[model samples]
Target chain A: MTIKGVLFDLDDTLYDSTTFVDRARKEAIKMMIDAGLNATEEEAYNILQRIIKQKGSNYGHHFDDLVKAIEGQYNPKIVTMGIITYHNVKFALLRPYPDTIKTLIELKKMRLKLGVVTDGITVKQWEKLIRLGIADFFDEVVTSEEYGLGKPNIEFYRYALKKMNLKGEEVVYVGDRMDNDIIPASKVGMHTIRILRGKYKDMKGKCKYEVKSLREVVDIVKKLIEEGV
Target chain B: MTIKGVLFDLDDTLYDSTTFVDRARKEAIKMMIDAGLNATEEEAYNILQRIIKQKGSNYGHHFDDLVKAIEGQYNPKIVTMGIITYHNVKFALLRPYPDTIKTLIELKKMRLKLGVVTDGITVKQWEKLIRLGIADFFDEVVTSEEYGLGKPNIEFYRYALKKMNLKGEEVVYVGDRMDNDIIPASKVGMHTIRILRGKYKDMKGKCKYEVKSLREVVDIVKKLIEEGV
Candidate 1:
């Protein structure tokens, strides 16, 4: 079927989310040591990685836990230093991939509808869109908070399709996560292109279509349309 | 007294540091809420600012302190989520002002030796220079860590001058800070241009040259050469 719209994931799919955050965190850990956190940069970072693993990245207080683990007590001073430094460096480095906007523009020029199917708080995700200066490029944005569901939910993919007023077979879904974005949307009868990014950069996915950058999605769309895939 | 070099202060002077940071933090707070934190967006944000104030931005764990103050426990989930989300949004929004590169290019084309005199750890400051893609434009970058002296230390300014092999009268010091940068560099006989940015914006200074952007420094440099100001 010919594609009528291109649905996408926001974070790693649209940008180099992991690299910048990883750099910001590593920098913040260095600051924590300078501020008397009682651990080497490597030591602190390892601890942080463990904490993120156990509690999840969505958990709020990695540094606080890090200081207590290293210092054997709750120390606000060390924790605050780590966070503030983390903040300064993190926001200072945030930016989308160079080809992100160009890819969006290219998709729009083909008269294809562009929509975002992301798993985040509605307003927070919207803030990312606005701050990245890409909100105007999308014809639709469906977030987990608004849909009362999240990625991996087949109906959530369907919700985006419904919002775009296109059938699943006529839309192509692009995302970084195979389990979250690709699988569910594939099951929904939409074409799936897993855009390899961040941790998934080298992984061989089960999907028929995989791209290294958002820019490659353009060629895939053209092929899919010509071949009626 | 003709200008032979331009020395810069990093951060807001070379880029729009504050706005991106503020937006990143706000977006992070929204993520904190989605991760099951208490407090409205405004309330959480107000508390975050207060913690940043009391602990200073360099203190590593503002989010942890925030959770304890509001929830009365050292909760790691909310804090880690806050930090991660803060980090994601923060680095995603980090960028140099639109005119930063162009301004630096203009100064370089004039054959003026460009240098950076900034406070902070030497390597960290250098990382910023490298990431901003302006490190190559600078002939020298003297950080507080390298000089064993921080801002407001007149000797550090002198140190930069010594490295450049230019007399203070023949170089212009451009910084966002009146007290740390302009006053100290001016005392060493350099023509000082206060680049008003972030909190320094709109604040009147005693220096004869005040600029709202690095772009204006080019004109001032040309004017200083022609008039020997």
Candidate 2:
């Protein structure tokens, strides 16, 4: 299996997304308290946490709910302030794992094609890559927003394979999700590598390879190359 | 395992939640189009679908995003109207599956205790039961909001067992989600039944029983009672 191209999931695969989100959430809570949320810091923080658990992490109205809960009315300005603070803190804190850049650089040295096949808004995905200073390492970046497809859809994987001008067997897809990354990639005959972290870590699925960190991916790629896989 | 109690998850377990949500979404899109947004019905529908996929079903600001995308500004009144229309349609369409009430009535005849162990806001969960006209069928109703716990947590399952005054083995727990319901109920020593509907139908997990509908649960409970489980 001569792996010609390597694709990755952006959020948790290249960076510690959970930690970043947690830290940013705490910061946002503090900002909310400071911005006349009418609650003690601890009270506001707990209120936000409760809202997150109830409405889920992706819930866009959490800030609105928080304001309404504490102040008995929806305040757009407060919600906007909270969202801005949250994203600003999150982006400011976003950094790739220490081995991420080095591993990508090493893989690039092998003349292997690298790409990112991630499910996210185009601008946000690109921003993360640029912020991490690894945008130049990849030959292609396919985001769901731009590609008109998302993970678990084999077309999403095929798009990257097509762009790299490589067959599925000639590519390796690495991500933290089983259903979204490993299963779909494997179905397309691409080698799938499961990174054991993030929300989907406990999700059960079959894959060709598993690794704990990006550093370990370099070793797997080297082994694959040596075996002509 | 003398099945003295039967616990159920609400939502898809009792009714076709997917169908309800789909209908409600279509109605909401219609409402959005009629409320001065500049788009055709089809365009509005697609926008809502895209927003749902991008931000997730639980996203609190989907209407805000939809209005901003189509109208170039966020109008709180429009978002509120969208939400009101969506929920109104959903609740109006909320009806239990045909077999749901009959199955519960039959199960109740056997002198076994009935309870609802659900994860959602207290008012919402109760509203579903009340709307289904099955509120009195349960001897107990334990929701995550009031109980301070959610599914897959052993504590959440244990709370139901305690309330029923029965050991885990004496209870038969049925739900749609393998990770959130079956696994945790099994962990707590309850007889687990996976109702095969909902987003998690394909999730892999170990359970003592699997069924297609609430009607099948009555049969399982009867068998358990006969076998003195």
Candidate 3:
């Protein structure tokens, strides 16, 4: 409907956080081993990734805790581990999928307010936004670290709508997660666009729209914007 | 109710996050003015707090964004602003109410599995648990940030039960927010306890049980745990 604003997700929607995280996890494991941990890189990587998968982000495992568990103490080792892991995984490898830039640029030209609603760590996520050089492209960025709440929680969606100064019906939320992203945004009356590329291999739901890639966002929004429904 | 597990909320239920957040907001405003932003500490505090209140925690004019806005670029000034604000607010002022620690210890002594089901940011929240020296008290922490979901969404409660390796009937979920906490826990087949500590004065609902303090939790569960039905 009028389409005053557009909200997008960061990881797995625009850029591939999985690859960056995988690389980071590998480096972290190496750092742990270098710091005298008995576990192999694969073992540490598996444990870290498992934590993220279960807890949503590996950073939840405080670097200090891991350092203590691995090194028997918390000291510069934790900092080194965090820094090394961060450098390895930090947005350098976060290649936005083909057509993401063009889609965002096109959306900007259409004068639609842009925002990001991501369930990501604070510092790392913002760093990615800046590094991608897409920081200014968004009118606002709503990260879970800042929100104290995350997706699938109506509070988060409501916050984004209020920040964008748009009602649920006036904005469209595009994301990849059916359980976390799509359902919550849709429940708040915001139209949802599910990106098909990420984890959803057999996603089925009541989404307002779906696209195979970020490139299709423009066309989908254009058509939906024209409908004014 | 063989109280297999007891889940507590971090902010305002076990500890008052509002007080901590208020302190942090005030400190952040001071930092902003000290850095020569046009806004006073009071004004800046009001603005930041307003953003959280009107927009929700994950929405609008984040501390980093605010620092960037004032400095006219991305700088550590914004990062430091948030760090200091959250630190002063949370670290200095956040404290559990009377008997909070005692109650938790008692529950632990009774061999009740303790967990935390909170709609709060994972990083800072886990920090709070550690700061309060109560991190070890919980068997699991189902933070919204970590879970990618929050209360009022039944899945969050269901996940908590799963983590506890107990059915909904086997555990009791407790929190302050009626809409976001108690009712949703009830819908998932978990018995609920509503703590009306006046923090959630606006909270309204018909919950299974209500108490003024967490001290009541032990008694409530003690009675319910004995009745099989």
Winning candidate number (TM-score): 3
Candidate 1 regions exceeding 4 Å error are A227-229, B1-229
Docking quality level of the chain pair in candidate 2: incorrect
Over the stretch B1-229, how does candidate 1's per-residue lDDT look in tens digits?
5889999988788876778778888888897788677889999999999999998765777988888888888654456567767766756766777778999899989999999998876545655665566777888888786788888999999999998999999999888888888899999999999887887776656778887777898999999899975
Q: What are the per-residue Cα lDDT tens digits for candidate 3 across B114-188? A: 988877666556656755768768878777866798877889888888888888877888888888888788888
Give TM per candidate: 0.51, 0.48, 0.51
- Lowest summed lDDT window (length 10), candidate 3 chain B: B76-85
Model 3 achieves a DockQ score of 0.02
Residue A117 in model 2: lDDT: 89
- DockQ scores for all the models shown? 0.02, 0.01, 0.02
Candidate 1 Cα lDDT to native: 0.82
Candidate 2 residue lDDT tens string, B1-229: 4788888888798888888988887887776666567888788888888988998665667877998998998654355557767877987898988889999999889988999998776555765776677877988888786679777789988988998899999989889988888888888988988988866788887566888777888888888788876
Scored against the true structure, residue A176 in model 3 reaches a CA lDDT of 85
TM-score of chain A of each: 0.90, 0.87, 0.86
How many angstroms is residue A209 displaced in model 1 relative to the true structure, after the best TM-score fit?
Answer: 1.6
